[model samples]
Target: MDVTFGFLLLFVATFLVAGLVKGVTGMGLPTVAVGMLGSAVSPVTAAAMLVIPSLVTNVWQLLNGPSLGALLRRLWPMMLAILLGTVASTALLVEGDSRWSGMALGGALVAYAAYALLSPSTSVPGRWERPLAPLVGLVTGVLTGATGVFTLPAVPWLQSLRLPRDVLVQALGLAFTVSTVALALGLGRLGEFRLGQLGWSTAGIVPALVGMALGQAVRSRISQQRFRQFFLAFLILLGLELAIRALL
Candidate 1:
């Protein structure tokens, strides 16, 4: 596709916003970026462009956390399952229509955001975590493959674990990093992720990093609860717009 000035501007703006969200909340980079760009580009293209930024940012997030080895030991099954599930479902990216992808993305976003807003006090029992982890990973991987959004059950399930704040953030980083890599590999196998696309994706890292820095700078000043509410509300509106446009 031709990368016009307008498109480049849109690309930068999209990632900047996405990175800011991630910086503030320690997640949402792919979800916000893909959802915003899906209207202007193919879902495949949007997902492709986000590869570098999402991977880089999430890896940074992952490494910054305290308990890498333990988290990996505990979460490996789920992480491996996510990889398998994403690879298994990648054909859908090639075969699915844009409208279907849009609807699915919209639905995933709305469902996740709505569930988050409800803030249910649900927690997974210790006995169930082992079995449930793989199931959640597989389902999240499928959704990530189909829609390029990995927040739904994955984020919610992670929250249920009730890890300490910093550990939870790091865990999110690890999960998102895995999801981003899986999506990149899936796109690469289909020949949808090209050198030219990688160039653009690489360029996005600058804006994304800048946005993240800015967000982090201001993070302490704002009420995280209020900001999250606003963010989730914005997602619901964006998701509704995408779904409505696809259906019409």
Candidate 2:
């Protein structure tokens, strides 16, 4: 895709919205970006564009966590599963393909949106982690590899783990960072990565960061429940639109 001025603006705007959503809700950047931009361009392109900013933000999250050592010790199995799943899925599905990949990405978005809007619950028993970690990791990793959105079961599932607030946030960051790195490697292996796309993705971080800052400034003013409702509704529409486009 030639990076036209109009599309460039649209791309930046999308990231701004994504960043703001993340600021308000602690998630949604990848879901929003992939769902909206994937419809406009190829999902592959959208996924590629997300690499830098997403990685940077998640890395910040990963670095800020004080309990990294413990989290790593407890989370290694799940992380390893995620890596395996991502590598396998990306190798098989994402490279050298755009049409079916778009369809699948759209489907994943729709499913995730539906889950968020309908059965939203935040709490996971820590006891369940022993059995569910690998399963969650595999699913999330596959989703990350294919659609560049890894939060579906991961975020809510982690929330269910009911870790301390700070630890949960950091854990989510580590999960995202791991998935992002895996996806980056997968894209690189498939030769889908380009210097131009990397440049654009990196440049996009500025608007995203700016939007996050603005969102933080105003987050206290808005009703978080209502904001989440609206955000999920938007995601549903975006996901459906992309799914329809994929069929066409």
Candidate 3:
């Protein structure tokens, strides 16, 4: 099979698994999928595959999550920061050296994973949290635009909140939705959203939905603590994987 076709298959499989993780735990779509796919293809392709599916999947989340009024009140500071940071980061995207961008992002994920496991609170604490929250959005935006690895800082911050399963899931879903739309626009401006690319990217929606459907059916069977533990472990391993791939 051609390398391109192989990568397309990889995208479907990656997001299918990502969708399962998202449906079961309410997050991890970009984290798991991008971590794996970024290793196999140009980060651009990995990100492109996610565009359509993420947009579709997050619509459900936006509707199902906490009320818009409540989420806006609670998360506005973080959201505004996200907008500014995404714009800045996307503007600086260097199509020239994405490998280095990948390396930087891979390292950031590793650092975040280490902190989460070692911190007593499993949280970043108060003052540090608010400032860093926006920075997280900034960093993730840069990586998302440059290397298609868009989970780093945001995931850790969100996870640190230690919200109830549903709240956390909804928050992640909403956040992902916002970020994905910004990215889609950025990619379009860069001429990265051609018809053929959009078509294949859109194709992943089927598997994404299917995986989420299957995950929802089984979500109740899984233990929350067990899922959290696995989630942390997955981040650690994924961080390591990206680092290793970049180094090699």
Question: Candidate 3 regions off by >4 Å?
Answer: 1-11, 35-41, 66-68, 91-94, 118-120, 124-132
List, residue by residue over 70-90, the lDDT tens digit for candidate 2: 999999888998888887778
What overall lDDT, based on C-alpha atoms, would model 3 receive against the true structure?
A: 0.70
Better by TM-score, candidate 3 or 2: 3
TM-score of each: 0.86, 0.78, 0.82
- In model 3, pairs of residues that clash are none
Which segments of candidate 2 are over 4 A away from where they belong? Answer: 95-123, 164-166, 218-248
Residue-by-residue lDDT tens digits, candidate 1, 74-149: 9999999898888777778767765776677678768877877887455689999998899999998887777667
Instruction: State how far residue 12 of model 2 sits from its true place (Å).
Output: 1.5
| Local distance difference test scores for all models | 0.80, 0.72, 0.70
* Tens-digit lDDT string for candidate 3 (155-232): 777888787656766777767777888777777777766787688778888988888877766665767776676667
lDDT of 3 at 105: 65
Model 3: how far residue 193 lies from native, Å:
1.0
